[model samples]
Target: MKHQSSEYVVVIGGGFSGLATAGLLAASGHRVTLLEMQDSLGGRAGRLHRDGFSFDTGPSWYLMPEVIEHWFKLMGTSTTVELDLVDLEVGYRTWFQGHPDPLDMTTGPGAVAAFESVQTGAGVALEKYLAYAETSYGLALEHFLYDGFSSVRSLLNPRLPALLPRLAPLLSRSLDSFVAQRFSDPRLRQILGYPAVFLGSSPKHTPALYHLMSHLDLTQGVKYPLGGFAKLVDAMAELCTKAGVKIVTGATAEGIDTVQTGRHTRVDSVRWSDSRGETHRLDASVVVGAADLHHIESRLLPRKLRSSSDAAWKRRDPGPSAVLICLGIRGKLPKLLHHNLLFTQDWDENFGRIRRGEPLDTETSIYVCMPSATDPGVAPAGHENLFMLIPAPTLPEWGTGGADGNGSEQVEAVADAALAQLAAWAGIPDLAERIVVRQTFGPGDFVNNVNAWRGGALGLAHTLGQSAFFRPANRSAKVEGLHYAGSSVRPGVGVPMCLISAEITAKAVNGIKDLGPFSMDGQNRDAREPEGDVQEERVAK
Candidate 1:
């Protein structure tokens, strides 16, 4: 059942999407060579080491355990074997600006109790909301996420007609409005709406359909990989290597070489520069642009060959950027949990400033991750690992940052303000003095390092028009063998979405279209193989 033909595939960017794409394609009998611009892999899910502390500089919250487990299973392994995942007792701690006591959020009965404490009958309301969320989550996983909307006819599934009534309101309304309809308390609404930030959007702009995100954490509970996100990256890299994919680090893709065949055009090879500034080109029958889609479209591909042009991108929202603060503290912070969120009272105004391209707010929502609480290996015995994220506008005017706050004034100012805010809000007045090591990464770093569009921390915002079939297509309209896989493409951002993007791109390359999730029994078989070939396997399953 293995693929009979093996074509040379070149994957650009060694991020989660790129690494996952390479591994999947290689496993399907393609000779894959992945090029990463950075010295190391992981892209946005990056790790930083300072003093005796290790910080997950990028994504920390490990949501969607099922997706991760599915990915590991696809790679011919299990999550239990590849990762040491710990289910957090407390999902996260939310501290309001003026409130003295912090609210600890957890799944199931604990979550209900927390909500009930805030408002009478809120626990019942929460259960109702979660019921809808869980249903949407299941429906999306079955009918939407895995399927590539290659044709209009693909939308005509029998199940969709019955489900559309339930989904219509979710798609049309904003998440903020949706949550407000269910809960009167602002804290309850904020708790439900804050997940929109993970989608690189504001709750006011994000579709209510994203409420399904709550089901992942509020129902299933939050989990963390013991060694930070780097462990997940390392595991993916190892899988790619095992699948015979050759990974090249410090390789910056300069251009995509193409050749015309009659009326059609296809990618020929990828030309990249190594760390030593030496140029090299490797012929590729197929090319997957798993990096920043904007970077790939604007820089690598030729103007005429580009599927999404600069003009097209200008019309889209590039999403909010962030000022990332990584700290290595000398003492323990018992007040903080493994995950902490400091939310401003005014959610609308805070989001409005970023959406309107206004200046950074004096009072803004910020997320803090203390991974050391769960994993002792991340920091020294007496120290704690702290990572803070302050979401900001993707405006180039905001400037950049560097290690120890040596770079742009604006970037350092934001970091300083965030620290003061954290200290005051969390009741740690000497938090700044406790910092033994510090590093600040700004929007500009996203541009300089990952070639992120408008220095965006995440890719395109998941606005209604920028979602689902409306998102930039995975395969190029002009080029035959050109495909895209990553945050910017269909199925949207996050590590789980990126992994799904990889599978979609891989399946498309193998001539499968509009297919749902792969069956466990058919894991090793080519998806595009004739039905007769896998009939016996299907029967056995």
Candidate 2:
């Protein structure tokens, strides 16, 4: 709770992380200014409203409800209006090539019985597996993700040495390998491994430590914030304003001007342009570049002041982008549910083609979200709002049959073919014909709208070496008083991780020192508590 007072902190980007950072800083008695390039806020989590249809354009799955509750509580806001969280009875449905019926997944005691119903003895394994996953999840929030870490030295804490044995899986194994080793059924394996898609990496490439995500999915639960992600955006903006933070939208940040002292260089001010082509420079003592990490570093800051090298960035694995198609249908689609994941048997090949900058796979794996099924207000009466997404490479103009990889025209052709395939696979014979409102956002849209580096829909890829303390640090090593938060920074991608990143960076801004990556819990924990005591708390009632 300790903080630096009376400093003017300028936050670039009005996204979730930026809003959280600005609110935290202002609440700590600092003067904060948040500049967002877009006319409205929400960044990637932006909403689309047209002709009586509303859809969360980016993140649809609302996981980690605790993060939101904790954030609101910390900001001294009432959690009553936080979200009308609905616990999905059927979290999602997955369609496999030859499967007769779709797979229905849920959480808690019933979940154990359900898995056991599918495969003998598998339910017993699930119960035990989730218990293990819960332990990992607790260790994550309590030890590392919530705590501030500036350098590798954070890992040198005394507590970490005792925790090293448990951390070996994160260092040595992958999620897919872990699932394969645990479950025998391929259907169940896919169900367990699908959570990796949120991390924006292949299960084979994601670290095994991320299996805690399974605990979140299977044991904990998936939630939908009534009114979509935009509700959180509204609440966050309101919180920031209440905390006396200035929110400026449609203000595009062009550069971060610096002033060099004897040994360190400090961000002097930020130069930004409004929608009308008017440019202005605002002075600041601290700057939080939360827009896009790579975009800010490569374009906003001077080359000489950048701490990360282009070669180093290239060496790191980037997360998968997407080709998102939001269709407002004219008729009801009973074949789909709140969340549907359609996959071909060639799952690995699908990921391979997408990750390698090749065109989308012939048999693409698609995620179709029909929120209207759960919330009638999201669509017109007797109709469904279909949000379709294909995890794709962040390429220029590349489409299934686009010319030279940059034409939006080719994206339409790609969309048509994919829709036909989706209809056949999902057993919805008239899928394409139901569209009354259509919007296609490809990689080209990603770059133009949010300045996404390489059209990345997710943050940086959560590869082995690119994870944990190895990911980009929240605090800048070269620029004094400059910090970062969001999917691109440490703790990796996802809405929950971004919230944690905001907390970590906020604490750091308030003069909290990084206790290395594995120091004991900093918030509400006795500094003297030994790391050996780290364990999962009881499940929330």
Candidate 3:
């Protein structure tokens, strides 16, 4: 294991994907510098601390443990050593409107019983659905998620044709219809279809291929890094530092300087501004745009060197924007769980409003997280930490937000409605009054802070048109020595996908086209080897 070539690599955006890309490149013997606009490294996976309460500003659920573990192992560490991960006993609690009680979802017999209680023979349907999901998950891990789609031959596996029949329907049909076909109960369908939100899509728009998300939560279960998602961010930042990455926070990337080398335009250096408005330049052999792809291309690079144009981006779905409400309540929320979902009875109408770019609906579905239930460190003693996520349209009409009710009318109104809903549904009528600290983050905040396209909270929606090989490539099609790694790019959204995206980007930078998971031995294996052989090696290890 030696340096492939000591190229200077500049990774823009200090999010999970950015940090992971910087660390992997550094580990592979590249001189790396990571630039983050925020004062902190974590982008969306940010932390908000106020009045002795700490809230994970973005992602909370820790699914896909293997993906997390794989990245840690690659960095010469283990999750057991680096992260104190707690396997949540109850994956999540769901409260459907009009239902008398909430369903606490776990795994095995309990999950079956919960579903069976809702609809006759629904328990059996769940088992069948999960079986398909587990198979799909395994297939994706083996053949799809890891591959960068560098070559058409990357998908020319002998096993693929055999699996195509089973996979075709999943790829073509909407997740909503797929779940509806299996179970007649709306609750069961919601449980199966709700994972679409994680992909920044509604079930109607998201392909059923994403049903594999169910396997990650239902079969494998959910885990939380002990201090909160911020701990995971801390771990990633630490790993990047240990791998010799120079992380510069509060440094905004102004533009990417390029050189026309022969027939290709290559990134020469990145022009950035510091917190004090000091301009600086860093020469690099390669640049990874780990931020929002739309921001990177439209703003940073010159139009001639841009891979995706304004017209191109318009055709793509920027995914759903969200309004995040963080609250520090005065007393314990007995009814709240670490993870909770409040589903509206009319799923079609709720999601339809979002798709049509309508205003936030009165009865929209919401996700609430009470991390204090699992981690005492998040909030002061006797108080509760609450976070509510409402998926809204990417429309600017919703506006931005601030601390202690200092937000635009539309944003605050959504928060107000969420609090009222929580009080009514969770039996906590005084939820609003008990809030000792209140903060709201909306679409405008996403655009202002992260340069999100159209204020989309997540990168791109995982629709049939924007998935897998159809998604944007990691390497720049127009510029040489330019790459991408993040939710906006390949494997899709979520912390785990971002980590995997880093590996894919690293492989492209290393000039290794092996469409399999990179070996932990720090060796670039032959690209010609079947991906199954690599899987076998991992298992044997």
Candidate 4:
């Protein structure tokens, strides 16, 4: 077979991690063939469009905007060209028990005050807890996350020795346990533990290191893209095309083929079924798997090497599969801000039922994203593109409340109920009547489109046992020329971490030097814009 020196690297799922891997590899002087099964590239960050209104699919919360921008600039474009990001003043509103007014946790001290309102010294306790979170977050970025840990020896580095003291605190304790120890009030505990679910796992199971979410949100701040996350994906897609990467949409990957002799193995190529149902094979020097870890392991790789029997592998990693309700409303919701979180009174019971695979509580928590409140471009004139999500488990256990094994129908009903609840919770006037166009994505929808294993919205649970070295490594242990990225792999979930994971994976594939994890702000400050930027010129179709 003829081979190209700048190998035709086939990137299997075109989510944030997959695209980032493809884009960086192409920019670094390698030819890349990106294969995405869906009609779109964003993966979990899916897009919905109707009557000139656009809505972001899954991940509505935009943190670390600079991570996307930095990669784009590296490939000759800035985020500004395709998406306008506005920093939120009130990051999120949490309605604690007994407090009539919800806690607007934009300011750090205000979050401290929420605890203070419950007890005299709770504010001081929170300050101390936040200080500890800050310390662990700094250590994690500097030592644990940035470097690729090829083996256990690599994790025992002397530089990371200082992190040893924190490892017990961060690794041994769950987010819920850590918060309960620090706060006497259950209300304060709920508010603090809420962000842990962003990992897609419940706070009781998620690691304490996830406390970084507080720093990432309340301190670093939350941002919203002008046209939602889809705009950001579109911007990156434009850059990839300009960089000469071959993006094949509507192409479903089948599996990989590898031949081995002694210690070395050659990945011959990848096979995929396109829209026409014709099987297409492309020879490649390298292959990167960007889809779900289980899909890549079971469907794509040879069966002998799969980890189906491993206890850790078989255990369900509960990521809250979101039921997104997108509405193209006839008019704007002036009372709603750019971002809002509507909390239910019995939040614990709600999560308990979800974890148990029962129906989500009638009064479940909801996240509302009103992009028109910030960018105005997402919705048509005098209209709004509203995205509301209720987090729930992907799988439905037997004999659960009204779920009846058909998760799609049950989840859709839950989405409708949640929307109705949201309108009442937030006091939105005539919200049900205002929606001119609407759609919903349930667990089955995520499974069919993204091929997310068991319809898991996020990858693995970010618990102490499943994070960092515990996560499936970027470099496959048994398979050569096969690598993993996306939510399941290292650096964990979210757009920033996904992009970072891709960068590190590409470096490992190319044998390039590791660049330590830098903050989104740090990257923008250090990296220079290319002259005559490609983003300035429209790509020749």
Per-residue lDDT tens digits of candidate 4, residues 347-412?
678778777677776778777788788777888999987887778777632111212223446666
Please report, in order, the local distance difference test score of every candidate based on alpha carbons: 0.87, 0.79, 0.87, 0.73
How close is every model to the real structure, measured as TM-score?
0.95, 0.92, 0.95, 0.88
For candidate 1, write residues 1-541 as lDDT tens digits: 2333657789999999999889888787677889998999999988888777888888898998888888788889988999999999999999997898999999898999999999999999999999999998998888888877767766777778988898899899999999999999998899999999999998988999999999999999999999999999999999999987889899889888899899989888788888887888878889999999988988987798888766788799989999999999988999999999989987888988888878777768999999999999999999999999999989766777778878588889989999999999889999999888889988888888888999889888999988888888888889889999999998898999998888888888776554675433433434323323211101110
Give the candidate order by descending lDDT. 3, 1, 2, 4
Q: Write the per-residue lDDT of candidate 2 for residues 393-474, one digit (tens) a residue.
A: 8785653222222337656656776788778877788777677888787777777778888888888888887787788888
Error of 4 at 504 (Å): 1.8
| TM-score: model 4 vs. ground truth | 0.88
Candidate 3: which stretches are off by over 4 Å? 1-3, 520-541
Candidate 2 — what's its lDDT? 0.79
Enumerate residue pairs that collide in model 4. none
lDDT of 1: 0.87
CA shift at 362, candidate 3, in angstroms? 2.0
TM-score, model 3 to reference = 0.95
Off by over 4 Å in 2: 1-3, 399-407, 514-541
Specify the poorest-scoring 10-residue window by lDDT in model 1. 532-541
